[model samples]
Target: MSESLLRVVPTVPDWVPAQDAADAAALVVSAMCPGAGELVACRYAEVTFIDQGANFEAVGCPVCTAPLDGDWWQERMDDAYATRFATLDTVTPCCSATVSLNDLEYHWPAAFARFELQVRNPGRGWLSPDEAAQVSTVLGSTVRQVFSHY
Candidate 1:
């Protein structure tokens, strides 16, 4: 894991603007919790934008306990729509699940593209030895990924 460092603030850096970030944050908060009442109920009062380059991970909320992976797909879509980041080179079946209120469905196509996810840990989570192999394999892609962790 990489150690967190304290340093002087940067005058100029590669980043999106503060206003844009607030707008983006608003969009995210709204989507996650729709309706004005919910908006008022939920706390999105302060949105902090810390520059954690390359390695970034989302911590799940306590109530819904939704995994950050839930947002990962939409984030990719946003990248395609907003930033036009490229997709993985290969899409392989990683996991499967069924979602239903009344009827049960089987055999859902829940796959993970083993493309350059960059796999930067950012020192937040520890990477197991086995996980490191998978990360290495991702780094071995022949084609260049649009969003590079480097």
Candidate 2:
């Protein structure tokens, strides 16, 4: 079976409470986008690496936009799985510039430990900036949105 999720996670990942996440998620449903009513059925959850699946692939360098090699991608996935803080420094093959792995984008929704608010089957769209900002405000920390499938 395939499922789609709209996840709101605190950027710090360590300071969010499940109750706050739940409340923020409810606010997202009421104040966000058009299809956000779908979020009403969702709940709060803790995020983990296992949520990544084999879809855990890294993208290009955030600076030069050079695609990562297979070995580099594997190394990134390994680090993500093994470390609590998944940031890493690697040289880009194209520009030879050093970049933080956190700076690079990902092909899939990477897991964030601590807390996340998950909206299952949130119809067919993403959250607006205002909605995200509201969640961030409620959580008392910066937050990010992640879309995932399983």
Candidate 3:
């Protein structure tokens, strides 16, 4: 059976909050998603990719707004992976503009983060902007949510 995930990540890829902040944020998430089956707060030693899983649609150049080639994106991802995602900088295949992979416009809003808060099977849909802002305020960082089904 498919599982739905509500994944939240900080806007800054390398940012990880204090343990107390993470704990508080987890509690707030639990209260916000009361119907969720499981909630996990993860801290990574290095930045990690957070994808939208089966919800992925397409990626576009942030500069030109042209659709980026999947193969080309894969190559860049591979290169970034070589450094364990420490460097996301690349020249856009569409516009030749230097940009960070983190800046790419992912349709499903994938991201890189050293910290993640995940709610599995949240009975409700996406979080509203105000809810996100609340979480962000508690965590002391701007955050983005990614909805995933897999």
List residue ranges in candidate 2 displaced over 4 A: 13-58, 86-91, 96-98, 108-111
Candidates by lDDT, descending order:
3, 2, 1
Clashing residue pairs, candidate 3?
Answer: none
Extract clashing residue pairs from model 1.
none
Best by the lDDT measure: 3
Model 3, range 1-150, lDDT digits (tens) per residue? 999999999999999998888899889888999989999998888999899999999999999999999999999999999999999999997779999999999998899999999999999988899999999999989998888889
What stretches of model 3 exceed 4 Å from their correct place? none
RMSD, candidate 1, Å? 19.4
C-alpha lDDT score of every prediction, in listed order: 0.26, 0.61, 0.93
Across residues 1-150, which tens digit of lDDT does each residue of candidate 2 receive?
A: 777777766665444556755676567554554554355423224324324444556677667777778687667657755664444456777788876554566676553546666667677666778867777766676776677767
Rank ordering of all candidates by TM-score, starting from the highest: 3, 2, 1
Candidate 2 vs. true structure, TM-score: 0.67
* Per-model TM against the reference: 0.18, 0.67, 0.97
Worst lDDT run of 10 residues, candidate 3, spans 21-30
For all candidates, what are the clash counts?
0, 0, 0
* Clash pairs (backbone) in predicted model 2: none
